[model samples]
Target: MIQVRGIHKSFGEQHVLRGIDVDFHEGQCNLIIGLSGSGKTVLLKSVLGLHSVDQGTISFDGRVLGDMGKKEVKVLRQEMGMVFQGSALFNSLTIAENVRLPLDFFGDMTEAEKDERVRFCLERVRIDPESFSKTPAELSGGMQKRVAIARAIVLNPKYLFCDEPNSGLDPETAIVIDQLIHEITHEFGMTTVINTHDMNSVLEIGDHVILMEKGVKAWEGTMEEVMDSDDSAVVEYVFRSNLFKKLRAALKKA
Candidate 1:
């Protein structure tokens, strides 16, 4: 599990995160949802160690990130995986090659072992062997995202972080990706953190949801609790969609 305690961060004169405290449990899809400038990105980056917090501690399991040595930090990073918003696969590399890149860089495996691991990851993400040699440009958006996911899990990481994972996909494709992430999180028992504003994803797979407003954690709960919540911030943020408003009304009637 990942724990954030009273973490604060600022950039120049702009304060991004303010005393944000939350726990992201293992084997669950913990979602950080908010508007464009709601500090969601900053909080995610802070947890990923891309940005330093001004106060408080971010811990993986029980080890505080602020106290880890460089070597220790490196080891921790090796156990973490990230999927970017753009499905950041290289256009020049084939699907298999992209998935193998992490293994190539950090793995001590022999050539045969590397090949087996790469094949296993690709297959785990449901990518066919036929497309393994194709470049990212040749595949559809959904396929590219799957390839990205394959790369993220190639190392069998303990922590998985996704930034706007469903971005740019059609609704149906988005749902498929959401379900894929959900399944992988439980299957691998990884602590998965996803930063997204997609309401559908929030309702569909948000095992733990943290709603951010301004720079603070406005609310935290499961999806079912979100449906019943009367917190103004939760209501204002969630009911922005007419569909959800109607759903809430139906739930109330029922």
Candidate 2:
């Protein structure tokens, strides 16, 4: 599990995250949802150590992150996997090469070992190793995202952080991607954190949904509890629309 205790962060004059506290449990899809510039992204980066926290503590399974030495920090970083927005695949590299990149740079595996690991990861993401011959440009956006996921897990990291995993995809494709991620998170008991504005994903896969408003944690709950929440800010952020109304109405039992 990942825990944030009174974490505070700011950028110059902008106090982006204010005393944020939350826990992202392992084997679950923890969602950080908020409006643009509401500090959700900053909070995610803070947890990942991409940004320094002004005040607070972040721990992964009781291991404090703030006081790690250089070598210890490097080891901690090795245990993390990240999928940035836009898939972040190298344009010049083939899909297999991209997936193998992490193994080459970090894992002390022989060539044959690396190939087996790469193939295993690709198959887990529902991609054939034969398809690895193609570059990122040759695949569709959804395929690229799948490739990115494959790469993210190729090293079998313990924690996975995804920013906008379903971005730039059609609705059906987005659902597929969400399911794929949910499966992997559950299967490996990975401590997963996802930053997204996609409410559909929140409803579909969120084990814990944290609502952020103006740099503070406004609310948090599971999907079922979220559907019953009366907080206007959370409702407005997640369910205030004709479409969401239709969806909720459809979910009502006879």
Candidate 3:
């Protein structure tokens, strides 16, 4: 489990995260959902250690992140896998090479060992070995995202971070990716954190939802609770629902 307590961050004089507190559970999709500039991205970066917090504490299973030495931090990072918004694959490298990149950097495995691990990770994500020789330009967007997932899990990370996993895919494709991530995450029992603005993802996969507004944690609940909550801002945010809009219109006409 990941525990975050009183995490405060600032960019010079502009405070972005205001004493944020939340816990991300393992084997579930912990989602951070909020409007743009609500400090969701800042929170994600702070948790990942990409951006340091001015105050508060973040810990992985009770090990405080703020006090970790450089070597300890490096070890902690090795257990982490991140899927970026853009997929972040190299256009020049083949699919196999891209998946093998992390292992190359951190794993002391031989060339043959790396190749075997690369192929295994790709197959696990349902990417065929034939695509191993193909570059990013040769595959579709969905395929590219799967390749990114393969690379991420190739490290067998204990924690996974996804930033806007469904940003560019079509709705149908987005659902597919969402289910895929949810399944693999639970199977490995990995601690996963996803930053999303997609309500569909929120309703479908979110075991824990953290809603932020103006740098504050406005709400936190499970998917079912989120769907049925009485919070005005949450209701207004999800008021874009077709059924709700239709009900309002019919009531007004009556």
Q: State every prediction's TM-score relative to the real structure.
A: 0.97, 0.96, 0.93
lDDT of 2 by residue, 137-208 (tens): 999999999999999998888899999999899999999999999999999889889999999999899999
Q: Write the per-residue lDDT of candidate 1 for residues 128-185, one digit (tens) a residue.
A: 9999999999999888998999999988999999999999999999999999999999
Evaluation by TM-score, superior candidate among 1 and 2: 1
How does model 1 score by TM-score? 0.97
lDDT of 1: 0.95
Q: Which has the better TM-score: candidate 2, or candidate 3?
A: 2
Clashes of each: 0, 0, 0
lDDT of 3 by residue, 115-166 (tens): 8999988988889888999998999888898899999899899899999988
Over 4 Å off in model 2, which ranges? 249-254
Instruction: State how far residue 252 of model 2 sits from its true place (Å).
Output: 5.4
The segments of candidate 1 whose C-alpha lies over 4 angstroms from its true place after superposition are none
